[model samples]
Target: MDHNDLSARELAARIRRGELRASTVIRDTLDRIARVNPQINAIVQDCGADAMAEAEALDRRIADGQQVGVLAGVPVTTKVVSDQKGYATTNGTRLFQDVIAPQDNPFLRHMRQKDAIVVGRTNTPAFSYRWFTTNAMHGETKNPHNPALTAGGSSGGAAAAAATGLGHIAHGTDIAGSIRYPAYACGIHGLRPTSGRVPQFNHSGPDRGIGPQIMAVSGPLARRVDDLRLGLEAMAGYAPDDPWTAPVPLIGPTFRRRVALVKRPGGIDTDPRILDDLDRAAALFRAAGWEVEEPTELPDLREAVQLQIDLWLSDGHEAKLAQAEQEGDAGAIALLRHYADRAAAIDVARFGEIFARRSALIRAWRGFLEDYPVVLMPVSGELPFQQDEDLRGGDVLTRLWEVQLPQIAIPLLALPGLSVASGVVDGIPSGVQLVAPPWREDICLEAGELLERGFGFPALLPR
Candidate 1:
């Protein structure tokens, strides 16, 4: 039936109306994964047998006229970093390769509660640190569109799975630009909801540190913004284990359909092609009755990036460096070396100052959002890099890190950022990032839909 080509929402609706059986859909999904996963290395842990059993059970429930979940019959892939029950939460590192999970984190728990079948677990870089996905344990996840380009990291596998139709919607976590960049690289959509918008906790590991508490969040990746919205609704809810979680409403106060456009964050220019997409995106907004404004000045993203680094490294980098050494993962070691000097100087006092300064930064962005509900910007200053671009250390790696300030800065402000895939530019996938005030993901998704109107979702790979 070519069910893989439909959106998660559409598939779920079909399941609800008895037009499709959950077991048949999941079996087809597993078959597709078997055929395509080897080429991309996206799904590292196949949960095919378990997913099929669950699907069969769901089919029975539906036959009995039982009410199903919002994501019924939808096949999705979970990021390996999260503790999916009974699976190894490897985080793409050898250190935790044998540590089995005891229970599902908020993500998979919610996904299961909503009857979404997880066909496999996706890969990530060691420590979920690199912008490119690879590890000694699971190997590298390549872009489904172009193997030469990277599958954006941390959540790269999730994006690739969605881009290739291996999964209709994918579970993705974003602390920096993990979800957004991967979505851009693979020609899909991902949302980095405001911190705590989606509850998270790892029973397989220790409690989350302060920095992650303030910045890290789990969100969704999909080909359709509508599916992304459905993913969010199903995954968001209070989980007792996470102290940071709350019963925040999915929809927020309405605002003017206005957008603040940023071509260059911190005065750094983007690729010419990205600039053109930004132009086309703005025109689409205007045509859709949105007022687009190029603000004379915007929040200081460079400073935000600086503070984000300090807070992120507050737990000290030496321990991580030692772990990276033990894992013998080149990319992880390279990342640690690149930030050694900066992370070395951060301590208790610096962390204190970060929070004090963070308040003002958040206030500034909140004020700006009050004026303009959404910000239209590039997901990355550069296009998807050649695969393993970070492997070439020294100046090349440093430049790669600096170029992603647009992505690095958002997590610091605790705002919702949406990555909307525009189209393929000269064979590489290109996209824009939409930022909304904290807890206002609705605004970002609404803005993304408008930009998507101009350059519809890219066709799935392997055509």
Candidate 2:
């Protein structure tokens, strides 16, 4: 079998058993990226020499019989928004094109500590906004399944790269379906670890505002459920620099393998195909002995989604507009105009009210979560839409928000969401998401595993 096509679990096993060397694996990965990335536009920046050197070091450690960490030699991509020492943390903006970091973000440091090789950086929308990955600086990232459709953003590059086997696991950040939606779009799996489950700190940038500090989180997008678990284990921890960082157990005793089926969180209708996939996923879980219940109603998800916009728009509007203006990119300017009017009236008091209500909502969600281990829901209201189709007018923004309702809502609860590819719907990839209580990603993975098995493990793109 081609080493590049192996799951992270299989590749790691081979590397540890000395059946393959890290250098060989990385070389194959680079070659795969070269062949497939052009079509997908998934990997935006290459860190070739750095990746090779890291792999060689891992090979040497293996030869010396040293203790190698779990992901030793696995090739991975970092999202542009995350900081990696000595690399430009572009954050998908020309404004920060020269922004270099002297130290790694906590997640990157942790990945390196686990001996994972940094292969490249993935793309995002400008300022990591929007549900599609496109920017004047990095360009659009096409879906591996169908180039016509969107590869959901802001982690679209990561999801595309992972789907195409450019890397076994791609690092991603989630603020509103940035992680899970992309995974669904690209026909793969993504995990949005509960806020602070993963230690995160960026030494190169100013402290983010409360909105981002609460809603944004770093996570992983990968080809398999096991890889997601491995990636989360390597990244989750407590960092003194991120005050919200929490120490969560990497593994805990198994809980009741029960999941709540939320056909549409907040009564919003889901695409028939997406609804079918969710039903199929639920049946798969049932066959696996997991009790699945169709919860009559979900939490006040619409309220949570709206509050997310309020928090994000409060103080972020001017900052985002100024950054876009600085970039002077047509696409950025267009997006700024789309959001500017909606955010025009936000004030300090309104922002504070949103924050206060957010806390209350989180508390309420936590209480509801205590009853259900996992909530299986649609990753998006529909599958990946035509790329740039939404750019046609103002109504598209509402459509984008409607389709991305779940992504926006989950973050407000400060919980984790996992998108597992169930199967393809009419040649386009379709997936279901599993939402777990804050800090309990195990439930998400448990549900993800069942879905993967039922789906028959679809092949990597363009093999």
Candidate 3:
């Protein structure tokens, strides 16, 4: 059987039924990665030996009448920035390449506890600060569908891996659009759960500063939405190490089936093709017996986006800029400089301003969600841009972030957002973004399933 073609759900079910040995599935997954990874540069660090050993161990355990995990025999890749025991949490830079992790982070620990084999570690941008993925360490990851366009940054490798069947599910992190944009760029689905949904901690480094503590989170990327659900359930287990997360259940109570559809988020000059994608998604919801409406305006997304950029500067950009300069990666330097300029200044009062505004914005957005439980919008203002588009600087960088407004704004609200592939558009892959109330990832997934069926995207896109 082509194990690479099976969704995590289907593969795990088959394995749990003793239809396939864990070792066989893992060997096939490694073979798939060896054949496809070079073209996309997705999985930066291969764990083939470790994977085989674990797979064999799992097989032995099953034969000995051990309990089966929900993700038995499933293959997944964690982002390089995340801790996976004995691997370097490179985070796309060589500065800390020697800083090997002694223990797995909360998410990785949880995945292993559920018998999900880690086949490799995916790439990320140098500082994981940009929407385009490229770095001096792991090199650039290309879009598997069209190398000319971006594979999506930070979590680009994760998305590319999912798109090309390198792994059944790809683990990703989202502070901005790291998870969603890559999924959109590579024609896959990525879920950015609520801030506290999945435990977040990296013992290999100092604890996260203010900005990341609040917005940054771990999530799942997969070719199938059901695989995403499996990945999430495996990852969302409680880790006492991370104070942000709790013992929350994956399923949440149902809310009204009403959705608000916005053509342009944060007043972006959305492309006509993107507008068409939104219409297509809306039609799917309507077909699913859900109410879809186009509101005159929602909360001030533009302002929230600005605040997100500001939050990134909580520690100030000087040190970050210096690090990027040291790394000397063109893309990292360019992005760090680009956004740092926007957030540069001297102000102790900025912290006060940030929180007060954050509170007010949260209230506004949460109240808005009270009326519309879900919001369907474009993943970006335009289709995935040409690879290294942001490196062009000036108008290109400006335009890139303008369309990324939806992605950059969502994190500030601390809600669950899902990116569901809408199939390739005009030779470039594009998709729709779904937002639900905090801790209500189930709602987004429910709606994503309807959109997924309507779009008819296969579990894996053609590479």
Best by lDDT: 1
> Where's the lowest-lDDT run of ten residues in candidate 3?
339-348
Output candidate 1 Cα RMSD: 1.0
Top model by TM-score, which number? 1
* Alpha-carbon runs more than 4 Å astray in model 2: 330-335
Candidate 1 local lDDT, 1-463, one digit each (tens): 6886787888999998899999999988898898989999999998999999999999999999999999998998899999999999999988998989999998779988999999999999999998899889999899988889999988999999998889888999888899999999999999999887898999999987788888989999998898899999989988898888888999998789988999998887699989998999999999888999999989789989888877775466888889899999998898888788888788778778889999999999999999999899988899999988888868898788778988999999999999999898677999889999988999888888777777886687875
Worst 10 residues of 2 by lDDT: 327-336
Clashes of 3: 0
- Clash count (model 2, backbone only): 0
Q: Clashing pairs in model 2?
A: none
What TM-score do all the candidates reach, one by one?
A: 0.98, 0.96, 0.97
Tell me the whole-model lDDT of each prediction, alpha carbons only.
0.89, 0.84, 0.87
* Model 1, runs deviating above 4 Å: none
* Model 3: CA > 4 A from native: 459-463
* lDDT of each residue in 1-463, candidate 3, tens digit only: 6876677888888888889999999998898888889888999999999999999999988988889899998988999999888999999999989989989998888889899999999999998987788888989898888889889987999999988888889999999989999999898999999998899798899988788999999999998888888899999967898988877788878699999999888778888878888999998888889999998979888888888888864365788889889988887677677766565663669778988999999999999999999999888898888888888976787788787899999898898999998888556887889999888899999888888889975546444
lDDT of 3 at 113: 86
C-alpha RMSD for every candidate: 1.0, 1.6, 1.3
